[model samples]
Target: MHGGILGCASAAEAAGLWVMPFAGVHVWLTPTGHERAHDDCACVVHWSEALAFRRNRAVMTVPLALEQMAYCLGKEAFFVALESALHQHKISAEEISSLRALLPHGFDELFRLATVSAESGLESIMRYRLSLHGITVRGQISIPTVGRVDFVIDGWLIVEADGKGNHEGPEQRHRDHLRDAHAAALGYDTLRFDYALIMYDWPSVEAAILGRLRARAGRVVAG
Candidate 1:
């Protein structure tokens, strides 16, 4: 039997690691020998053997938690957490290498996508999804008057991933409006997506981006 949190719950405790909203705590406990615990809506319990157990720590190590997270969060969410952890320096390269060795062969490409460039889970997910569509996204780009933008595509469109914590309230909204206005004046079109839109309604977001890109391409050809 193990005490304390493990897996996704442990990863969520780490700063900058974004996890999907879940109820109740995740704990590792002993089940009938070799049997894993059944997860319910309120709590998630793992009865499997821990990869590395530390007596002094209250939670699983960042690497172990991330390794366990793969099974619970699936590829997209797990990849987002991995990149966020890397960007926050919560996990090191050596630790990641060790973690990779323990994972199954199918996870190889997902692990390769981990990068420190994504400032948030939203950006990490967005960048990965866009890549799947063969879109080239340049992240964290700086335009002269616009300061630093989240991503730039086709050298004309700016994409911003807005998480709830950072982009909230009227004042912040006003600031964002000004930023978009300034960007537009410089001939850069801006598309700002909040957490819900990017996470849930992706088809619409993809259509908007692709439609804009296609329109821009048509205009350029006509010119």
Candidate 2:
């Protein structure tokens, strides 16, 4: 067996700091003769200098794990995990700054976009996607009688990205309806998207949001 530390998405997932779907294990072995003996199978191998700071013996340090994540998980998944780590206090802003030098060139902006306010991977993804369209989203906004919402767009639009686990059951459904009703009474438009809709049918979600924005824009102009 190869004596190596689990890195990248594998390490991130194990730390409970990653929620995105990934395939295969990623192991980081230093460039040593015994470490690089045979060709690998499904497990991804990274030949790099493993950092000394590690919480778990079997896994690499958070910074090193995140560096490997940037290389293997692409921008979106990496950003999601980074935010999750930040939210959980597993990683710090200083640690994230250290990673800027190690990541690919185009990924610098992702470090800037990373925020601890993102409650879940689904919220992180939705915010990132909307940012692509030049939409500025404010997250974790509190409103009287309705409590806190996920993302608020254009000051009047409440966009809730509900994950599979949190928003289930009849009681939760009833609460959600009451929140939406309260928001409506306060002249706010609520657009709620579930995991399936956000992940699979994004076009329809985008269309609905865009349509609402346009209508809101027209109302403002007319008044």
TM-score of each: 0.80, 0.86
Steric clash count of candidate 1? 0
Clashing pairs in 1: none
- Candidate 1, residues 1-223, lDDT tens digits: the string is 2343445655455444776555566665433324333444455666555466533333457776676677766777678778878888888888888878877887887776667888877898888788777777888888987889999998999999998778899999999999999999999999999999998899888888888887888742111
* Model 1 worst lDDT run, 10 consecutive residues: 30-39
RMSD of candidates 1 onward, in order: 4.7, 4.3
lDDT of 2 by residue, 49-86 (tens): 44433323334777777777777778888888888888
Overlapping backbone residue pairs in candidate 2 total 0
How far residue 188's Cα lies from its native spot in candidate 2, in Å, is 0.6
Global fold similarity of model 1 (TM-score): 0.80
- Evaluate all candidate structures by whole-model CA lDDT and list the values in order: 0.75, 0.80
- State the displacement of the C-alpha of residue 196, model 2, in Å, after optimal TM-score superposition: 1.8
